[model samples]
Target: MNDAVRELYSENRYPDLSHPVTDISRLWVSARAGGLERLPEPAACRVLELGCAGGQNLLPLAARYPKSEFTGLDYSDTAIRKARQASYEAGLHNIRFEAADLEHWRPSHPCDFLIAHGVFSWVPDEVKTRVLDLCGQVLSDNGVACISYNTLPGWSLRSGLVPLVKALANNPAAAGLGDSVESVAASLADMAGGGTAHAANVQAICRDMVKKGPTVLPFDDFAPVCDAVYFAQFASWAGERGLRYLGEARLQDNLPDGISPHAFDRLAPLATDPILLQQTLDLLSGRTHRNSLFCRVDAMLEDGMTTGVVMNFAAGRGLVELPPVESRVVGLFRQLLEEIAPSCLAMQELVERTADRLGAGWEPSRHGRELTGWIYQAARLGGIELRSEPLEIRSHSMAAPRLSALNLHFAAAGRPVVDARHFPCRFPDGHERLLAAMNGSRAADELAEHARAEFPELDFHRWLAHLAERGIVE
Candidate 1:
């Protein structure tokens, strides 16, 4: 069964660039914010990713942190071959992709981080068990493991589409499955004629699934082996395997959203318990998917949540401080943005600077809770990010911008997510020319001359400032 699964993926090839949130650094930031401590530093950590397709996720990590070691396991020979080729092209020497299966493979050494994204619910029961068991075997004492899977209740609505899809298109692995899914979906919609509610619902789902392309339809929604569990059942399953829930990779999900003002009033009793709280929130949000982080059951808990790490995403992408709605904290948010707008800062530093800008005797400890809450809001908005390491902003004095080899290669290849310092960047307009100019051989004046000729309207200094702020160049 597992071999067949591999064959399908290898032949079909799921070759798109994976999302950056699956990066261990993102998990590290979320875990620290969620009150887990003593995490292995990203620079020095060893990482293992099960079902890592084409090394899209780990190659950036290897490129960013030269000291870290990354090993990706995938049963698809085609995927592994492409991953190896990519690493070779990027000149990344710290990563390896091996063609191996979860149920049969053994770990050579313990890893500080283990990632299993998009693999849990898609594989067979035995393979899923082996994945969890492998995490237990390979994870270090203080290691953090991140696993993403489809969840119940939220997925309950979507699950109905599976049987309907299969009934129409019996063989999910057929060559034109994508086209078949689209055709059957149209036929179903025509049959419904906007009368039967269930038929209408199924047709709507099929129409939505068609956008994902035929290649993705089988494994994503109509796969033969996909399974989902409620949050509680998943927690119990992990506990039985010697792992405990830490938090979701997205911190906001782990915390209450205050949408229902009395939610905490009603669920406060279960708030102290991680699993119960997660399950309750799952019900509230109708969450269909989860990116969960866990650690060894005996791993030490922190005294309090960390304020040490800085956020990763660049500011102004989706983070903005609105005046009319959140008026109360708008002033503080505005002040912070003005002070640290294209530069990254630690929470404590941001607070102190806010205090200094405000007036005399303003202490960070005095406004600790309020400041932390605002920072959390800013983080949620994507306006501010928290990271353990501060970025080194490039200045005009520097001879040339120091871009990573991976970023250079990605820019040339037009890959969407490029490695920027230790972070992944998915800028809208793209940064090809800017990256191309950062060959380390060009001096500041020479680069400026080149930029002026290429881009007449662009503010060369502003471009450099933006690149520096994004940690794309140092």
Candidate 2:
């Protein structure tokens, strides 16, 4: 073990980050979308995370799913010390943490879900191989693994500059990163005479790195080793170890509809192989990183979505349309679905009702394919979700908007609130200021009256609907 590495982490703990894509529900759903029906339920499963600094990502899951088991492993003793304390203080009984070196730590039993977020690209080649090998060995028969990394062609430009960034980072004379980053950006500002995509790529990456600032720079740009590889190369490594790519943890990445069909169509014929197609897509799309999901090579994964396998998707509950959701065709469905908060309707009923709501804009016979594509894409984008089962929440719904005991508990404790789907969500801050009035007894207007002191400008009724839509309220 490198003492310097441990010391670096002891002083500079990486940010406490949580990703919806890393959540079991999202991973299970992504697997379901890929036609794997037999994976463990998100509500009751065993999850293990490698490189889990402070256990921020796994902590919330353990709290949200009491029956499930979670274990986080990290090499940093300080981080593990903090994670265990946090877990204990939160009264969480199902989660555990180990200060383990990934090179030597071994799981006593297989985990249903394995996560190695941001570990592959930063480690040495041998450690990277061991990560894939460990997944192939310790992953349960029905497990899914999410291994995220910096990808090549896209990340090539940024990674090539790492050495330079590190060299500049060594200068103690510079008091802050702003001036140092500016010097780097200024140096590259004239690349390709400042007008080409290559030049723009360099400048954009430099700015993004700077925006992350000092908190991220020490471990990232100035780390001893930060590497990136081609998507195909990474997949090949996993494949050699008996793990095969299933899909992406971020569902939207698996869908090609984000880009114009014409553009995608133009590139499809050039790359006949799917993996090559993905590489070409990344190159063209300027994607610098990927969160690829993998499963055992022999797993029963298919090409299309199937029934009997659960898929629970949901749309946001904002009163007005939200960005990352600009398709006019899906707007009506988003509006109609937002009202169905605290619950999810079956796809058929949902489609029929939403169609009726559309009236003249949608016709069944002409728009079947279009409608399917729209909602499915919307679901992928989280504008709407498709699920095989109704959400199991302890709170009552609709007539009297009440916060769930869990949500109320989280809010009262000054912890971040998680949506019904178990994603750590960004709710309007000072929500605790309004939670005391949401006990199912207060009328909407009365609640609005109380909210006026803190949120006079917010559309109270719509905000309530938004709360329900996000599954924050009962």
Candidate 3:
């Protein structure tokens, strides 16, 4: 099974790109949200990424944090070779990659942060055991580990399509999943019928896989081992290995969408077991996958509940996805957030602001819970972010905008450059004069001044802002 899997990957190498959720900042925030204290800082920490592929995820992190050390391990030599080459090209020195399976690849020192993004659910049972065991053995006292997996009930229908995908992978004439997925999905949609759960699942998966690119096909949808377990079952496995559930990496994933407050109130009491409660919510919402955080059981027991990390986070984003409500307080809070668009405020500052704005009737000691509750709910609903550090986006575009030369080269060649967000995106056609003008030298400002005539419709300042947003400039 291992040889076959290794051969499959060598034949089809996965494309490299950043997986932001696996970033230690995200794991730190999740752990902090769950009441952990004194975890390592993201700026300078020991990090490990299992199944790191071509190092797209870890390499960016290494570049971002020059003070940090990183190690990437994968079973495939092909993936590790490419990762090493990429790190060298990126001029990164703080990272290393090795071709070794989780079962036998033990590091001398434990990592402050460990990531197994797409590995846990796609390997054999013994390998899965090793993953948990290694995590428990090598994770630091207060360190957090991230693992993602397919969920049950929601995956029940999708698992049926896995065989078909695997068959396509074995086919000789079939070139790749790009075209193959379209045809298979089309036939499956017809068989599943319109408006059926099976049809919806097929459509959603196909769309997402295509958007994520070819790297997803063999590894995610048609791996040799594709297992799905309930949240409670996974928690039990972690507990047996001396690890405990911290929280969901994507906090909003914790919420059972489409449930009314009244209905949830009645159901919440019956499901008091936190693990069982999350599993029930998964079943209720038909959740397909989960990004879970775990820590040593002793670490969790030692440090009890505290909201210091969460409360100090610089919160931003708006209250766009608030829960169903008609409270005047909620309305006032939402309005305040809207007025401060594109700017993050300290949690305490937000709390104090809310207290002051609501007249003398709103006491910070008592009614602050109202503001905090709304903040938590809004965050869970994917409306806002609670981060230890604020993003360094420019408020205004630069007059003489400086862009990465490599990025401009890609733009001119019609290739997508990894953006500031670390996602791949390309500039559309018809920006020839503009791209040519941005030679990364001061000549950009002068040449752009003339090209501004040739391209009168172009808003130079706004265009630079767009580039800045992509991390290509500024």
Candidate 4:
């Protein structure tokens, strides 16, 4: 095979697989079920993952929903072997991993869900076509398929340098391909020497590549055949296969503030055509990545949960701090809620509600009230509490703006847990004070003594136990 093909098959070429499949599956299940609070009635949902390296994503879903069957396919034997080993070690029986070229393989039965992450942008046109065709054929009437790709407009600026970099690296007489690419990048940085426009342009392209190249280029499992397509072309391509753009898999990316104002202004008017708008926005912003959802035209479109509602509810009950929602936007949210039918609880409805609310008025207080109600309703349905303690619950409609992102660590029923990723913690309540006291600086006994003096009712030991279980403390 070719050098590129060899690199793609090597297991050590890329970072360890860490897509957070368990979290993603939970969100998918919650969204499909209507909201995060309600678990969709158990159904035999079959999931198919394309280019499922090491089966990391598939295995988690299979484990979480034992009733749901999962099948993962990859072209790499190394990946398949690792996946099999991991499955055997974990004793997972609900998943199967196959080493088959997706371009030639076909599923025997229809799938309830399809997921292809980091696959679309890197595969050859023939493979891309087959993947979509398979999705169309295998996806059930009510299923959803997620396909992530690198888009045009955003990619154009960054990709403009690909040819130059590749050409420079291909000069085998000079150095090896990998060494040449790195050397050229370094040379360009030095030549620019810091301020000239030529240097700036070269530096910008180099920086973009440096940041994203490792994730998508020759290191990608399907890199050998990748032919990145523009957003508009991709949408058209999917449309031809009878799949409609459903929105983005990463809900945050679809929000108005996700892109620059100039891009939003240009694309907002095209909202009636979501696919076109998404393409235009992506191009304008020079976005190189996308996480898109597509549904079959004949499939029944179910109203699904909205991220706004989920975040709002999570914030209101102290599960998380409220994210920054501008005062002007809050007003529009209220108006939208008023117009929507109470029973019309769908993903589209939430979007429309947000648009209506923002377009109607700008009252922060009223908007906050409505958001709180939505959160309470969501919590009631999901079976999770908004707040674990009376101290954690906020009685007023005041927003506790997010100060920092928190790293969430979770443990299975009996597993020992500790926070692995260091995240900035923002406490809206005295939780910050409590957190400060519990920092490694103090022993548990000392912290408990302080807790008794400050908040007598608070169980310091129990709090420490909870923190330990969550992997928040060592």
Q: For each candidate, what TM-score against the reference?
A: 0.78, 0.75, 0.82, 0.61
Worst 10 residues of 3 by lDDT: 301-310
Which sequence of candidate numbers ranks them by TM-score, best first?
3, 1, 2, 4
Q: Clashing residue pairs in candidate 3, if any?
A: 420-470
lDDT of 2 by residue, 171-223 (tens): 67543432465455445544434477667777777767667666666666555
Model 4 vs. true fold: TM = 0.61
What residue runs in model 1 are displaced by over 4 Å at the alpha carbon?
1-3, 166-211, 255-259, 306-333, 377-384, 391-403, 411-415, 419-474
Error of 3 at 361 (Å): 6.9
Residues 1-474 of candidate 4: C-alpha lDDT, one tens digit per residue:
345554666644343343532234333533343322322222367788888876655664565457878888988888888778766756678889999987678788887678887777676666778888987888777667778777665556456576677777777664643465655665565566658755676776675455544544555322555456777788788888988776665444554233655656666678677767776666545566777777777755445554444442222121323343445554444344334312123333454456554655534456545654554443433322221111121112111111111111111111112121112222334555656433245566776777799788888677665454333554
| Residue range 331-447, candidate 1, lDDT tens digits | 564566565555555545555556776666455554555556556665654545555554444433345776767666666665544544334455445346666658688877777
Relative to the unseen true structure, what is the C-alpha lDDT of residue 210 in candidate 1, on a scale of 0 to 100? 68
Flag regions of model 3 displaced more than 4 Å: 164-179, 190-193, 209-215, 258-260, 301-309, 318-320, 323-343, 349-362, 403-439, 442-463, 470-472
CA lDDT of each prediction against the hidden true structure: 0.70, 0.71, 0.71, 0.55
Which tens-of-lDDT digit does each residue in 1-474 have in candidate 3?
376566776787775556767766656766777766767888888999888987767876777678989999987788898778767755779999999967777788988898988888888788889988988898999888999899998888678766775476457765433246645554444555548665676777655655555556666776667899888888999999899887888776667565666766877786447797787778878888888989888785334323344465667774355555686665666676666645566777766676677777886555666666666667777787666555555666565665554445444544445554456664446664466456556554675577577777777667776766555565
Off by over 4 Å in 2: 1-4, 166-194, 255-259, 269-272, 306-334, 341-373, 380-474
In terms of TM-score, the best-performing candidate is 3
Pairs of colliding residues, candidate 2 = 311-387, 312-387, 313-385, 313-386, 314-385
Q: Candidate 4: what lDDT? A: 0.55
lDDT of 3 at 286: 83
Off by over 4 Å in 4: 1-7, 10-15, 20-23, 26-44, 167-180, 186-205, 211-217, 220-222, 256-267, 302-369, 372-474
